[model samples]
Target chain A: MSMSPYSFRLAAQSLHREKWINLLSVLTIASGLLVISVALLVAYNVNAATGKLPEKFALTVYLNDNLGREKIDALIGALKKKQSVAQVRFIPKDEAMKELKTMLKNANYVFEGLDENPLPDSLEIRLKREAVSPEEVKKLTGDIGRMQGVAEIDYGEKFLAALHSVKSGVRTVGLSIITIIVAGIIFVCYSTVKILFYRRTEEIETFKLLGATRAFIRAPFIIEGGVIGMAGGLISLMSVYVLYYVVLTRMSSVVPLLSNILFPLDLFLLLPLSGLLLGVAGAVIAVGRLRY
Target chain B: MIQFSNVTKDYENQTALRDISFVIEKGEMAFITGPSGSGKTTLLKLIYSAEKPDRGNISVAGWDLDQLKASSIPYLRRNIGVVFQDFRLLGNRNVFDNVAMALRIRGMGEREIRTKVFETLKSVNLRHKSDSYPKGLSGGEQQRVVIARAMVADPTVLLADEPTGNLDPDTAESVMRTFKDINARGTTMLIATHNRELYRNTGRKVIRLEGGTLVGVGPG
Candidate 1:
């Protein structure tokens, strides 16, 4: 028949009479969203924490003690010309020795065997915030490798590899969590709809005999499912925000490390979107699983 | 008007209707009287396109059943009123909205729907019970609401499959009278019933069926 207010009215009445069905469905959807949102938050934080690491350390390039001070001076000048290099500091043998002595002042016996300071003369290269590209960093090191006094060029490949390892590890965990939570949401929604059908079997048969179309029979349940999902998503966002606040307060110092990396608390915006997706996805799959 | 030409229906293993053919003309009231399993209910179902015939062509009000499209089914159902044996009243709705459903499907406005639903309920003697839900209403009242719903749209044909099966004799007679009055007003009626006495007393057209085959047709 024509789309009319009557269908909506009937749907409202049906939902009212079967309040438990809708309530259970909504709770199921909300739970699914909570799992999904929390998983996303954890993944975001992990990535954010890993990205903050490289900014703290300067790359130390050891000078060839043979070609010594003059070439080390030229190497520092060449590094300053690169747009990627933010600043450079040359640590001479004397300065390196002095810093080492101060670092071991508490443990005098640790430095007792040293005739002279064995520390190398080196250039500490600080990268611009925008200049931290692994590929570009490697190329810059190769250029510095040819410098006369440069005995060895070092940007800590081990450190870069370790940082990358954390990034991939966090991503895998995030993806796995997302996949499992989505599947769980669908399973929960499917059962909720099934319960709804179970609760209203008599009413459904009546509609069928009255010549109600399949769409007519289906629309109200679908609408109910959608509403449930949306509410669930909205609720999950609030809970997630509360959790985020508690977490940030507990580990507030880590906040500065999250600068341009993860979705700032603004990433909280993505939580609702994820909620909607989970809600809608769960309802469709749940609805499709049922048969009359 | 309705025509069935060599119509048959089968489930997975059992046949529900045989190669049955029949025609009921416009403005006629006919009873498909038969024992249980004689395909009486299945016959009415086919008229409403609730279930399609496996083989053969059936047409209702000039619409071909064989080639009916999905969109056209609702259009077909809208023009033919159906009163189920079990009443089929939506238990969640009040009597007013229940009877108003048929008219509401025609996209009638709220004001007009209220007026028309009240008028239809008055005709069914159910106006006083308008606010009561189906579960609160008596069996006869529920059937009456269903009848009111069926007649509210003033459809081309009315199909009732044992509309009185669930009611007592007195209530059944009253409901039949309502059906007769509606039929008199030029709405074709096809009622399937096992109770031969109901039709005999009402002096309506009666057709007999046995094992999915029409046995005899009696004069109205």
Candidate 2:
């Protein structure tokens, strides 16, 4: 009819006799969760950093020395009228030569040999953040090329392609790894509870004889499984935090932008929350798979 | 009340019980006697709903065995008590908690649970052993704990298979006395055993079974 005294004792007895087995199972689940969470953290930070580059990087469009000042003004005016062009700075010939020399400081001697400034006047274009995709930048550059006396446009092509790949791949792989890890955690919990159930077959059979409902027999084992998972996850999460801090301290030179990307505080807050959620999910799966 | 109508049970590769039919009335004490593997335990297991009959119908406490819903099997068991030959006592819990289990499942409050558990343990003369774990007790004491648990729920129908089979003859007699007293209080009891001397002298109904078939129903 309902959960009675007999079933509770049986469930406790079942969990108690097989403590080590349950502990091992929970640890297995926690390790999988830790892998997934750490992967997510890295992916999130990389995506954020990569996402900032395109909108801020500029493209300089060169004009021929023969172009009239009035035509250059008209072309620059047309680009500024478009909502996508956030900034339009005209670089004069003398100033462009100076900027070129400063950028190539390592090879300043080569530029010093020239009698006159070989650089053309240019317009430095900065697009609105959302309008700076590689394809959109190409389209904007093509429009500028059709203008009178426009010589060339310069933005690094290989860098743009690499940035785009990093941005897209993070999202795709983040989801895939997290899914696989969570599924593995659930499987671990299910098998743990299933083994415990198998070990206590006689006890469960006795509960049935004493009139125990399915829920009555299931509640305590579920409680025990959830407790194991939560404890294991929390311990693993702590270990992961310590690892993150140690790594950040030891290897910050390898990635100068890592600190600017994701705060350690954010991971500290997320780890326990993720652990608790994983605990609940693992317990639910264990309960669902057990025969009533 | 329990009734078996042409019930047959088949395992994966063997017939455990074949074409068995019988009716046991309310408030009657009967013994199921047979040699080893003579379907004695199989019949008790059916009464406990461990498995459904492969063929025919068994009605117990107003439930049709074949028609019993998976969710409602516990309801039939609520009115019946089963004491296993192995005792099946939980080794992790002390005696008090073990006996209180029957009441706890029904959501009985702690104060009431303590009172009922104490009362049940007193009946088994195990009130002094209430704090002891099953592994710490003698075989007879552990079996008595099992008996206390079964009767703690106040089941109207009691099915004990080989309840005293594992105990010494002296201990076995005391167990029989416990059942006899329980039956005297108007509860129906069925005890399955192969001990001829134990049941032959008692003034109770005896259903003799051999080779999975009933040979005689005699009065002790």
Candidate 3:
């Protein structure tokens, strides 16, 4: 027997009959989804900010003042050959002095007494983003400092470590919040569906007596839960988008970096789809154990 | 066809049926007449598989009740229509929907359900009230709606429990005539009633019960 049409009609009728309670359930689900979505947005932006810090990270390898040009070139070639190294640029001592002078143009008086440039010729080594961890940089620097012509190696180890910690902490807290909120939404749906089932006990009894099968009896309730969840998801999607638009646009002028925060439009679309699946799951659990 | 042999049923506090046995052949229309708590309803329930027998055997339309699984009870009920004294109708639904429910449960298409529901409502003289809700109908009208719902599926056996207990004399007579018309069309019927007037000149079999025991089984 094809029960789809009949069940759909029955479900539609039920939703109309119990609009008030169903509306409340949808709003409750939407609220939970909104909280999770906002947390996701904050975590996404934080991760993005922390992720960009590695692009500018580089190690300065100062060479011996008496090293020959060929030896410096050989050291640059060797550093470039390393698996973690992305690029190596040799800055001549004279060019470094000129760059330093431009940077301190307003304080030129501090450099007037120097007889000769104190800075040594250095190779700036940019590493792969994936190799920017404090431990990896420390190992690489230790290896490079032992080279014959290498004088010193410097990379900000403490800052890199702190950035990694912040990124991981954001991820852990974001996932935990989302999990609890998703479970809360499912419980809201479960309780609503169960209450609706009990309220319609008389009608269900009549259906049972009229030879309706278990599937026939459960179809409408299941559909109701799905519809409620989907609606809640749609509402939350709109709410989160509005929040993103208002807050981000207004705050972008005050904090220009806020404009770099990704909206993740593709992933946000899963809100309603996930809501629908979770709603169906909640309804299934609610009705599965009932005496039908 | 319906047959019961030495069927016994007990509730938590009291025995509802004890060592009861009877048979109503195909196309037969019979009555079970007894006082309150005489196990008349329990007998009907047993035939419909609403309650299992404590001991003994029951076969209806060639299906053995003892061997029937719980999942198959709905199929058994599809072939047996039942009416209650309280007129168990969905008040939120109109008479058309109420009658259509039985056909819908059978997964019949909407077009066929509409045709069958209208035909059954016409049979019970309720076609004009097809759009009216149960709450708007009188007691007798509500009972006829229930009868239409029960009959729309064209079941082989029909059971009624005090179908006219809540009706006035004229309405009650009219409802009985409808039942007679259904039975005349070759459907077996077993009606449970305490009112002897419902069976007094009908010339049909009447089984009597007293305190869950079969007191007599003979023609009314």
lDDT of 3 by residue, A204-266 (tens): 988888888888988888888899998999999999998888777998899987777778775
The reply for model 2, stretches above 4 Å from the true place, is A1-19, A26-34, A64-83, A92-121, A143-150, A168-184, A248-264, A276-292, B10-18, B34-37, B166-173, B195-204
lDDT values for all models: 0.76, 0.79, 0.90
In candidate 1, which residue ranges exceed 4 Å CA deviation? A1-32, A64-122, A128-143, A146-149, A156-159, A244-264, B10-16, B69-72, B103-109, B166-173, B194-205
Q: How would you encode candidate 1's per-residue C-alpha lDDT over A1-292 as one tens digit per residue?
A: 2334555666576667777866776676677677777777767777667667767647788886666566667778888998888889988888987887789898889878788767778888888766665776788888878766777767777777777777777778778877887777666656666677677888776655445666666666655555666666777777767766666566556775433333356545665565556555665666566776
Which has the greatest TM-score?
3
Give per-model CA RMSD: 4.7, 4.2, 2.5
Stretches of candidate 3 exceeding 4 Å from the true structure: A1-3, A64-78, A109-117, A142-151, A249-262
Each candidate's number of clashing pairs is 1, 11, 0
lDDT of 2 by residue, B72-138 (tens): 8888888888888877777767999778777776667889889888988888889999999998999
Whole-structure CA lDDT of model 2:
0.79
Chain A (alone) TM-scores for all candidate structures? 0.70, 0.78, 0.89
Question: Candidate 2: what is its chain A TM-score?
Answer: 0.78
Predicted candidate 2 versus true structure: per-residue lDDT over A1-292, tens digit per residue:
2334544555466556787897787678668767876887688778677767866788888888868889888988998997778999999999977777789999877875688878898999988888877888788888878877789999877788778777778778888888888777766766777777777777677677677788877776666566666766776677777767766776667886554645446655565556556655666676677665
Candidate 2, residue A7: the lDDT equals: 46
Q: Pick the candidate with the highest DockQ.
A: 3
